[model samples]
Each structure stands twice: as structure tokens, then as C-alpha cells.
Target: MTLTRRSFIAATSAATGLIATPAILRAQGKLALRMGHPHPESDSWQDVALWMNETLNEQSNGEITLQVFPNGLLGNDPTMINSVRAGSLDIALTGNPFFTSLAPELNVLDLPFLFRDRDHVARVLDGEIGDRLRRNFDGTGLHALAVWETGWRHVTNSRRPVVEPADIKGLKIRTTPNPAHIEAFRLLGAVPTPMAFTELFTALEMGAVDGQENPTTLILNSRFYEAQKYLSLTQHAFTASPLVTNADKLAAMGEDQRNLLIATAQEGAKRQRAMNAEREQSSLEALKAEGMEAVEAPDREAFRAIVAGPVQATFAAEFGSDLIDQINAA
Candidate 1:
């Protein structure tokens, strides 16, 4: 059978056909795990969340039911990760700069124009480099279950459209509070104001920051157009959210259950990436309908030329140039 994102979701949603009664389920004592993320329920992470929840509920015969908390209900990115590490939360899907904020080495992947496209990104992240980054969770209180693409990061502003490299100069842009992100924009000539994702909309509306960088899925889903005017398809970098669980909690699960959970996570990751790609194409039109103006061919090469050297140098000095070479070679 074909396994498109929509098909996968439909399959999973119907997975609970043989679900047990609440009383019987209560007696059976399910895992009742909590999974939290900062994105809206309409975002890719939530798509993954819903799929995993239904799949686990069916596959485990209701012994494992994930209680998902979306829209930062459990907390913001760092708080969610910290909760997972402390064993207070079962899982969290963390976006860039959040994962990089905790593990500085992973910041190398977010450098401007590093990923050529989604295929190149999946190749690198699902290969040796991805394994290396995931392994960094070892000895930390967290266990990395899977990595999913949130999609290609773009540029949006309440000011002028980012048509060229020079257009970004002096405009205060909101960035994730990761060193690499802040430094990359600084090198690209924007004043990078790092802040929590929860505060971004208000910041833009208040003119606290003239712009922010995020994927089109997020920009449109979160309705950033209400606060910003222009959307530029920079596709400068890729956004990835790592599915993480508390090390101790995950280690205590039975081998079968652990394997099942990982399998479900992989399935969700695959579907989520495909869904994000499809959503990006449609969301551009949705954003325009909501009053966002799209700028065409915003000198992607020019943006890359200006930021590549300094940003790559920053990464090389911090993570060793050899690693950068390895990723480029990947």
C-alpha cells in the first residue's frame, strides 16, 4: 500500500478500532506518558504526536498511551527539555537552538545554507552525522529517540522584504537563543535578538524586533503574518526537532516496548517530514491570503556567499573544521 503522509495519518487514526473500555483500560494500567512540544496542534510536531499516540495505543493494545501537550502547555522548549531530563515529562520535540542550546556542538548543522535541500538534509541527519548528534545525549539525562524535519527555515519581517543580503542590514531580527543562530545573522548584518518562541509574536507586534526566521509552516501556522508583512523564501537552513525521552524512564521500559516506541517514532518522523514538505507549498498561498507578500528569488546565492565564510568559520573553530568538512562531504 502507498505510504504517503495523509495515508499514514489516516491509517493510524483508525488504528484504535479495537480499543478497550475506560474501566478495563484503567484496570490494565497503561503507561500514560506525557509528550510536550512548543508548536501548535496544527504544526508538524503535532502531526507526529497524533500519529505516535494512536499507533502506540493500538500496537501496545492500550498499554501505552501518550498524553500530548502542544502549544507550550507543558512549557517552552528549554523547559520541556529540562522536564524530560528530570523525568517529569516523558517526551519532547525540540527545535533548533533548543537542542543546540543544550548541546553546543549540534549548532553546526544550523549554519546558514548548510543543507542544500531536504533530501541532502535527510541524508546527513539519518546517517553518521545524525548518529553522532543523537549520541551526544548519552550521559545527559535525556535519550534521543528520533530526529524529524520541521522544514526549511525562511525569513519574515514587518519591515522590508529580504530581497538581497544588504536588505537584512540593521533590521533587528528575532533568532533562537543559540550562539550559532545569533552569530550567523550578525555576520549576515542583522541585529539578532534571541528570545523565547512564546514571546515572538508580541515582540513583532510591539516592534521590539522587526523580523524573525522560521519555517514557512511555523510562520503561517502561527499566523505571523498578522504581525509581519513580508515573507521571503530564503530556505537558508533546515529546522529539526529531536524526539527526546528521559534516559531513566526509557531505560526502564521492556525491550519490546522500547523497540515498539522507537519504531513508532521513526514512522512519525517519516510522515512528518513529508507532511511539512507538502504544507510548505500550500502554506505560501495561505500566508498570502492572510496578507503576507512573497518576494521571489531573493538572491539565495548572495545570502549564502555573505554568511557562509564567517558562520562556517565560527562552526569550524567551535566544532573542528574536520566535522564541517565531513558534513559538507555528506
Candidate 2:
């Protein structure tokens, strides 16, 4: 049976009743917030989570603090995201793809070769384009707080180097369940297998999939180099992690408290973005040091030329080209 978001929520709703909320509201009006993400404790996601916790404590004069659960302790991306929407979880951090089902307009950001660089991403995501996409969260039970960078995604495989589109032909590549990503890989001549990120490493180790694509930071932090042999700097697409909270929960908070929560999250996002950029080269170097062959200059133009037109047209037909045009113009 296929599990849609609604069904997943229903299936998990009963289970949620058994889990206690980690947050505490003191008699003195102080509140503790709980946040969760799928990345390990060593990744930048955890670093920012801790940073935000400190900032929130200091800014709130000890009235507010965060309890962070990393490495999918709460659940995978989709589960945690649904928990937040269902008010069982306070907050969640997940890549754009995980939220696309709740807001399909976000698929625009998942397009291959869509973002030229970090600057282009900043221009779009930190501007009106980002605001418009965040508004899409309304009525979905999530309050979009801020946009954080996951960096440009690259391809890694155990089979061989993937420098051009043809190199990946017939190879099974694991991808996020984002339609744009699946469509892009399919157009590039590879079998696109979509699955949860949690299953990727074991699948690769067991030869369930030949390769996978992810940000250099995630590839290194997740230790994919142990199972994958080649690292191609495809930069096929950029991913953004949206920090979101339960919409009803946020609305229930005092005006000042709500503003503080949003403001601190955005500030944390800025720091995470800078840190992500600083670590990109170092992460790539670390992957190479780990014995993975690095394809420094893969034929990006060739790869992009193959998937750009068709993928964009297919998405535009469904989502309209106005947002795409706005992003391009930005």
C-alpha cells in the first residue's frame, strides 16, 4: 500500500499519543521547545540547533530553551515534518524535497542546474521568491520559519566515475522522492530510485543501488565514502532545509515570544549558510582524502543540457512558469 501524507499522519497519530512531549512549561511562564532533524550530531544541522538553543536562551532571558533530537531520533524527515504539522512535534528541519508534497511549488528549487551559485540561491530564497514559497505553507499546519542551506548536491557511485550523462546510463541511482530530481535523472539516462535518506547507506552497502547524490557536507558527514568510490562535482541541484514549526502552536504563543522564535531561527539560518559555504571545499577535500576519486570538473554543461528543458517544461505545466520566471529574473 502506498503511504500518502494523510495516511502516514493517521497511522502515526495513535502512536503519537504514547510519546510524551519533551517540552516543559514552568509556572513562572518559561517554556522549553523541542526540535528535531535527521542529520547526525556532528553535522552542521546539529551545530546550528545548539547555536539556536543558546541564542534563544540568552535572548529570552532564560524564559525559552530548545531540546534538540538529532540523527532521526524523533523520526525520518517525512515523519518529523508530519509530526510538526500535527502538533505532536514542536519543530523540524528537513530538505525542500520532503516538504514538496505539502507545497508542490517548492519543487521549483529542486530543478537541476537551477541555481548557479550560493549567491543566486540567496537572491531567490532570501528574497520575495522565498517569501512566496513560504506562504504556500499556510493551511498545511506548518509555519515556515527560515530557509537554511544544504549546499549544491553532487553524485557519488561505487561503480565508476560519472563525468557525463552517458556515464550514468542504466545505473540505478538513489534519489530523494522529489519528482523534479527523479525526472531529471530519468532524462539523464539513469534509473532513478526514490527512497528515504535513512535507507541509502545500507542500500549502497548491500548493492541495492549503485550510487547516490547529496551535498558534499552530507556525503562526508554520513560517511558515504566508505561505500561509494567516486565523487563527481555535478552540482546538479541545490537543496535548502526549511526550519518549520507547528502553525497552531506558534499562533498560540504570545506575540513577543512568536517574534523572538522566528527572528532567532532566521539569524541561525544566516550563520548556518555562511558555515556551509566555508565547509564546502574542506568537505570535498576530506572526501578525496577518504579514497573516493574526485571528478573535479565533470561535464556539467552536457549534463545540464540534457535535463534542463524537459524537466522545466514538465514542472511549469503543473506549477506555472511565473515563479520560475521570478527566480530567473531575480
Candidate 3:
């Protein structure tokens, strides 16, 4: 059955009210968990999902399995997250920015020029700083399983190469509805249009928006180079995919089942992060090979000078600088 976004959400919303649970138990006594993500099946999100399914199925002796939905078939990131929270969906994998409204403190992760490199990001997310951030998910109806990597975001536009802060001025850049992202672009003098990822390619192709920002893997997989002419290695911010499940769903499982789920998720997170890091440069080269005008070195320090200070200050004033301070110290 082909389900439109409206129908899908309506069905899931109705399921939330009508069904006491997500109906994980299927015929022949198998428990099938439904997992959805916004990325394509070829992306790391699906890769990890499949791995978890196989591993869990093997470990559980076919007692448990996963039914995967990729390419936003369930809905956009926020919609899938709402489904997970409302108990209509079993699990969702989404970038951290989408969770900020549920736990506003998560906005810290999206701040521009936040981490020095992938190593810094690993340190922050694997250490005490990661624990503090995940704790914010409590009471939000979603339980964080693990944080996976999405790599650093860069700018791709039809206008021109974004070599410096001035080059981004007045470009209609499509950004996630993340306050930090929108504000950073606004500060850089670009008009940031907060749009859903599903609508982004058409928006760029139709010229509704001039360009967008995302990791290289996504840009290549989505073929943004078809619409955008320039690829700037802005490395503006790092995005983390927090794989989460409904708290109720987790509680419904047996103790052993719950433990198995958490253990498998964390294991998958580590493998996915390593896969993403290893593919980062190769993905960039692939995009360039596909004819993207790659700006190998943008004036990142100059861009940071304009964006980081004020953005961090605004965030600090609103959320208190504890998370940011801790991340920096880490």
C-alpha cells in the first residue's frame, strides 16, 4: 500500500490511540520491532539498522527481529520522532537537532564550529558530556539508545563557492528547523529557510531555495550536486543521529529483551560511527568526481569568527553554558 504522508501520520496517530502497544508480536511467535529513518536505504542509517536486525535475530534465536522502513516512508524526521514518542512507532533514528524541542538542551550539539574534529566529537559524546546530554531525554516519552554520527555539515549552493563568510551573504540556504543552524546562517548573512529534508531536493531543483547544508554522504546519496553547483567544506557543525525508542515500548519488553536491545544499539552505534568517519573523505572525493566544484579549503576560521561567538553566547544565555562548557572542556 502506498501511504501518503498525511495518511501515514493519521494511521500512526490513530494506532497510538486505538492500540495499547505497537503490536510487535507477529504470527508464529516472533517479535518484530519496526524501525524507521529519514535517510535512503543505501545510507549508514539503513546499514546499521539491518546489522542490528541480523545480530538481534541471531542472538535471540529468531524470537525477535526488526522491520526496517527507510527513505522517510514513515514520515520526515520530526514526524517519525513524534510517532515513536506517541507509541505508534517502535523506534526512530534521527539527527539530534530534531529532538531539541523535546529537550531544548540538545540544541547545543548543533551549534556552529562546536567541535575541533571527529576525535573531539568522539571524546565529547563518549565521555561524561554525552551522559549529561542524553539524560535530558528523560520524561520526553523517548528513551535514548545511543548516539551515532552524521559527520560535519557543509554548504552546497548554486550561487558560487562559499570560500568565506561574505560569500554566503543573501543565499537562500535550506536548513533544518534548528534555531542554532538558522541563527548561524542568518548571522553569516544568508536567508535560512527551515524546511524538511524530504522537501529539500525539489526546493533546490525548483529554485525555491538556492542551496542546502548536509554531510557529504547525504549530499552524494541525495545527488544534491544535480541542483547545486558549489560544494563548500564549511564543516560548520557536526550532526549526531540519536537512535531512540518509545519509553513505553522499552518497558514493555522483558528484562533480557530490553538489555539485548540496548546492548545491540550501542554496538551498532560504535560501528556506524567508525564507518562514517572512514567514508567521509571518500564521499567528498566521490562528490567531486561527480562534478561538484569542491572548495577543499574554505576560510573556516574567518567563518567561525563571524558565527561561533555570538551564536554560542545566545545559547549560553538561554540554556546556561554548562553543556557547552563541559563539551569545550572535554
- The per-prediction CA RMSD against the true structure, in angstroms, equals 5.8, 6.5, 4.5
- Give me candidate 1's TM-score against the actual structure: 0.90
lDDT for residue 157 in candidate 3, whole number 0-100:
97
Question: What pairs collide in candidate 3?
Answer: none
Ranking by TM-score: 2, 3, 1
Candidate closer to the true structure by lDDT (higher is better), 1 or 2: 2
TM-score of each: 0.90, 0.93, 0.92
| Global lDDT scores for all candidate models | 0.80, 0.86, 0.87
Mind giving the per-residue lDDT tens digits that candidate 2 earns over 60-139?
99899877777677788899998888777788998899899989988999988888778999999999889988999998
Best by TM-score: 2
lDDT of 3 at 116: 93
lDDT of 1 by residue, 1-330 (tens): 432345345534532441221211233556767677777767878777877988998999888887666677767788878878877678888785787756778887788888877888888889988898888788778888888876788899988888998999999999988777788788888999988787888899999999999988899878899999999998888878789888887788778778989999988888998898888878888998898989957999998888878888988876789878888888
Quick one: ranking by lDDT, best first?
Answer: 3, 2, 1
The TM-score of candidate 2 is 0.93
